[model samples]
Structure formats: C-alpha cells, structure tokens
Target: MSATHALRSRLRALALTAGLIAAGAAAAQTGSGYFRYGDARLSLAHAIAVIEEPSDQADERRTLVFLSAQPLDAAAVAAAFDAMDAVREQAPAGGYVRLCIAADGSECGLFYSPEGFNSGGYGDLALQRNEAARIAGRWQLAEGDFLGTPYDFDLRFDTPIAPAPGSALPAGGGAPGAAYNAWLEALAKGDVAALRRMGGEDARGRFPEDDAGTVKESLKSLRDGEPLQARIARGRQHGDQAVLWVEGVDRDDIRRRGRVLMRRTAAGWQHAESDLSSVDE
Candidate 1:
C-alpha cells in the first residue's frame, strides 16, 4: 500500500472512533430525569420533598432532594464535601441534587452542583407539578460563567413526594415533646449528670462539672440576663429521630422559639442539639 493512502486510512479510523464516543455520550444524556453539570451528568432515580404545614403562620421552606445512584465524576464527591463543610450538614453518598423552594412555590433559594453550592438567583426554575403526593420541577442555568468556570447546570425531576415523618403534637404532650421538656428542666436545674444521660452515648463524657454553669452563662448572654426557660410546644418522632419545637419567655418577658433534635437510643430519647432565636411579639 502507498504511504499516503495508509496515512489517510488511519485518520479515517480515528474520526470514526471520535464519532462513536460522541454518539455514546449523546445517548447517556437522553433520559426522563437527569442532572447535568459541566461535562458530567447523572440520571436521577428518586426524589423526596415534603411540605409541612406551618404552625403560627410562620414562613415555611421545603426541601426537594433528587438522588441518583449512577456515578458521575470525581467532582461529585468533592461537591458533597463542599456542601457538608459549607452548611455543617451531612450530604448523601450518591449524586445529590437539592433545591430549597419556598412554601408558596414562588422561588428556589439554593441549587447544588458538582462545582459547589450555588445560592439563589443564578438559574431559572419551573415547577410543572407541586403537590403533596408528587412533585415535578426543572432548573436550568444558561451556559455562561459559573463559579469561575464556563459551565451550566440543568436538572429535571419527577418523583413522588413522601410524607414528612412523625406527627405534630402540643407542648410537653407527646413522647418526644415530653423528652424535650425534661431536657429543659435538667438544663435549668444545672443537672449535668442528667444532661449527659439525655445526650446518649455521644454525650457520655461530653459534659464537665462546670458545663451547666457554662451553658447558663451562654444562655444568659443571649436571653438578656435570664436563664433559659423553654417548653416544647410541638414535636414529631419518626423512628429513631425526632424534632421538638419550643416556645419560651426570656428574663425580659420576651418570647423566644427554638427546636431540639433528639435521637432514640437503647436508653431512650437523647438530646442531639438545640437552636434558638428570639421571636417578635
């Protein structure tokens, strides 16, 4: 064979291979539910977004999470780590696609990508169906400068909405609420031992002899010289985890509100953490 002819044949073979690779990629992108970030993409298989009824007419936000077991790239793992570090919350193992939507379905506040977390106002969101039993939504960001990279994001999800776990109950009534009330009592009485017990194995040696005093001082600084006096106003328990909302009056008689997270161990419900803020009267 002539040298020129052989070289031309080799080029044709390489072109054929490139075309085949492109075709395969195009096939991967065709699906019912998918998340695409830059050059990588994932097929979302499941979704969960529960909308809880607001208590006391407060603003409520709902989270819609779409998960895909299909592997994307190494960047997905890095993105999960970034989310955990940025929010101090645990991220799911597989491809994690999340959106924080307002209760009225007016807007989406957050969007997750392989690059990292993106705050509100970067994309166009559309909700095709938003209901208690199911939800369908799409988020698209135009191809442009995003997070110092020339990339874009697109996610389309359609999946059933699972019911939010647990039942809501009045203060100090249900089991979880009662447990929260007990925790408040222990904290007010400066009972470190009881606090440790309520904290479960994770809190076995966490509290020191001066821990109660330290906590009180911290509360005093936030509560205007008053020790924390709170009562669980509502609660819900789902399996081993529970959330209890508390309402209280501070030293200045100002209203305060917070939530307590609890985990049920063999010994019973154990305190996980609490977050409190002053409520406008």
Candidate 2:
C-alpha cells in the first residue's frame, strides 16, 4: 500500500479501538445498561416508569402486583422499590412467612423490612393465576431482564391521628389558663356564653351552634356523676398554637383521652379542633 493509504488505514483502526473501549466503560458504570428479557429490553429508567404513584397520600395502604416471567436482578428489584419509596427486608429464616400491613402502608416488593413484608404469601404482591404466563407471552424473563404483569393488592390501614402540642397557663394567668384548658372548663360548665366570649364573634359559627344545647342534656344525665376535670399530657407547641393531650374521667370511672388543638386568640384563647386518642383512652 502507498504510505498515504497505510496512514489512513491506521487512523481508521485507531478510531474503532477507541469506540470499543468507550462502550466497555459505559457498560461497567451502569451495570449491564438496558436489560434484555426476551423481546423487550428496557433501561433502568424505563423499567421504573412502569409503576404509577397512588392518588391519596392518606391512602397509605396500597399493594401492587408484578408477575415476573422470570427471575429478576438486583437492579430491577431496586428499581421497583424506588417507585414506592420503600425498603426491603430478608424473609426470616425458616420462619412462617409473615404477611402483614406495612407501617407506611405498603408491602415490600421483594424482602420485608422493619416497616413491612418484602415478599411471599398473600401479603406480598399477589399474582393472578396466569399473570406471569401472560407476560411471558409478550416477553420471556431472562437473566438480565425482568417482566411483571398486573396484579391486585389491598392495604390494611391502621388509623392515624396527629398528636397535640403542649401549652401551659402562661405564667400567672388563671381563669383563662391555657387556651385549651379554658375550652375544657367551658365545655364542662355547659357554658356557651363563656365559649363565645373566649372564642370571639366567630364562636357560634365555629361550634355546632345547636350542639351547645346538647351539652346540657349530657350534663343532666351525669348530674349525679362526678364533675369533669381536664388533664393534659404529651403537650407540644407551635408558635401561638398549642396541642394538648386531654382526658376526662367521671364518678362512674368512665375515662377517655383526646387531643385538643388550641390557638391563642385576641380574646384570650379558643379551641381549634379535638380528636379521641388511645394514649390515655
């Protein structure tokens, strides 16, 4: 070959070698790149895109099913977990497959974690009779790839409630102690007027206007019962608003613990909201 032709050939060879080296390096960094199952090959990003987020954050209990035509890889499994912001725990050795609701209300896609079960049993993603077979129809499972078909799942929601913040009868303040306490006292007294005075003009609109009448009916039933006392616990505070763990007990020994959210208003204080809790119930 002529000298010029030899140099051109050498340059082409050099370019090919560089391209191969670059491709090899790229593959190592991303761990096998796009996974190939059978007919379908998907990148990690694409695989994760298959799952969709649920509608309500309050709907914490959710289960998802994935029917895999074949075994899955670590990366594929990790991708599935990321879709739900969940973790996985190893199935306990020789233990009964524990199937239970997850704390975050999500089942683990693979392994169980402190939060929930990872895999196996009805608790994990349940498979349809032929779901995996259906997926295998479109694409066979391969060593490097994963395929999942749709399946049904449900969540057992443990009811939840927010804790109240704490507040005290500010320093020497009395009669109108803590905002929450004042509301409790007014409630105990069947004192609508007192509630309105402390709650401001908005009081009537705020409380069940007609419900104020019911307090007397309730009091009449308990006339022979003990007087009510307000106790606060697990107190937490935020700015002018304070939440209190409140409880009431009567002569009959009936007890109930609740959360009361109170805010400091110009009139003194007012109750913002309340709910029953098991802490002292």
lDDT winner: 1
lDDT of residue 97 for candidate 1: 64
Root-mean-square deviation of every model:
12.8, 17.2
Query: lDDT per residue, candidate 2, 190-279, as tens digits?
Result: 676776666544566545557856555544543223226656544545556655555657445666455554666676566665554332
Least accurate stretch of 10 residues (summed lDDT) in model 2? 132-141
Give one digit per residue, the lDDT tens place, for model 1 in 31-137: 13555566666556544444433332346535444444443232222222122232223344544666666777766564554546565777788888777566777
Report the lDDT of model 1 for residue 233.
Answer: 60
lDDT to native, each model? 0.58, 0.39
Instruction: State every prediction's TM-score relative to the real structure.
Output: 0.63, 0.35
> Highest TM-score among the candidates is held by which one?
1
Using alpha carbons, what is the TM-score of model 2? 0.35
